[model samples]
Target: MSWLALFFLGTFTGLLAGIFGLGGGFLLVPLLSALGIPVAEAAGTSLIAVWFSAIAGSSLNWLKDKFDGGKSFQIAFLGIPAAQLGVVVSNLFPDRLLKLIFAVLLLGMIYLMNLRQQLSEQETDIKLAPSPPTPGATGRKFYWWRYASIGAVSGFMSGLFGIGGGLIMVPLQLGFLAETLESAVANSLGAMVAIAASGLIGHAWRSEVLWIPGLCLGAGSIFGAPLGSYILPRLPNGLVTTAFRLLLLILSIYMVRASWASGWV
Candidate 1:
């Protein structure tokens, strides 16, 4: 039954990965821990699910003509090193401290989602929208500072929290990188492949992962990912953005509750 539950979780994560290009760790860690898995172990195992799901999701995006390959690869190049570094750094922190930090990140995400939602509503009335690409906002072009910053921060967070940084990446791409919801999600999925793999390597080195659970999760994700990517391009941007924000909000609340229960707050 526990394995079945984990499989369901992975299925959901795979869907999110396809739709949002996130590593799906935002919800996985807390849920796993709540199911009696240790924090580090949960993170480690989650990375495995993230890696497989990301592969499937990203592949789907490519087939669906939803991805920007060059830009995505550029971000991945910068994110890879940063992700590896984050994995090393995460082990140095106490589990309780890490939970607190993760909780804080969740709060920040919720705030960002709300802000973006408001701005989006406002923009709907503007009428003339060329996406008004900022002078150097996120896009096809390589904005060194922008990509570098996102890579470093999201990668580290991905490693630290075992989140594969998709949550952070999507919003950052939209807010600062000057991406639409669609492109942000596509690029984010591309980046998660590297970020989650780096984190998984670190965890595997420490023998923190449970192969049975990881395999079960990966198996479920295999079926869910393609389905999600298939649905992504068909959804309205506003609907997709709303769903993303709501998902983050729900996950943030869950993490906050878990942190409090664990006395990490």
Candidate 2:
């Protein structure tokens, strides 16, 4: 693709990542495939893009005090190694099967997102408070072990499917740490940087990244991320999750259809 095209893709993906706390790999992978990259190659290239975008977005969040660096770093240490392991496992699987699994997983996540949103909305008077850092309640007493386990799971999914794993991470944080949704989103974006970086390193060793396009996408994300992050705080949690879930559902269906049509199923 032309440098201009790559730049625009990067910018757009970065903006989305900043706004949604996504790695933006879900969008990047499909875009790369449409540009004629092989499935495995596209996944690898997408990881590079995701890494750049995550770094740019997370930096902005950090500067704005939207993320805690100490906490994020701890999670990354756990996630990064696991991400490499996931990349190795992905390399072993057939691309077609991998795509199919990704499609199904996306569908499942969309459904779960929707369910969570609905439940949140139905409980009209539910209190929205920042969870206290307590042993049994907050899981902070076992922070290292809990975050490490979460990071490992998230990293594996990210490497296997070329996704940011925020969809998984945010919910896990909410369930385990009892974090507010916005806090979870911010922290997830920070965690994604480590996961994407590890995956990119693994893919680079395999010569699977398309540097030009990946860089282009990264450049765009640099500007767009702050804008998205700015908007995230103003939105209601239920509304944000509902919109995100709907978008995921639509994207999931499109992926399923495209895979079937391509006989990759």
Q: Cα RMSD for candidate 2?
A: 3.6
Runs of candidate 1 exceeding 4 Å displacement: 12-22, 118-127, 130-142, 225-265
Worst 10 residues of 1 by lDDT: 132-141
RMSD of 1: 4.0
lDDT of 2 by residue, 34-137 (tens): 66676667777777767766777677677888987666776677789888887788788766566667768877887656544554443333454354343464
lDDT per residue for candidate 1 within 1-265, as digits (tens), equals 4889868878877787667544567777877777777677778888887788777778878899997777677677767777777777778877666666776787787676666565445445443776543544343355755766787787777766777676677667766765666677778778778777877888788887888988888877787767776889898977887787777667667666766777654
**What lDDT would each prediction earn against the true structure?**
0.73, 0.72
Q: Which stretches of model 2 miss by more than 4 angstroms?
A: 115-141, 230-243, 262-265
lDDT of 2: 0.72
| Colliding pairs, model 1 | 138-177
Q: Which is the leading candidate under lDDT?
A: 1
TM-score of every candidate: 0.78, 0.81
Q: For each candidate, how many residue pairs have backbone atoms clashing (under 3 Å)?
A: 1, 3
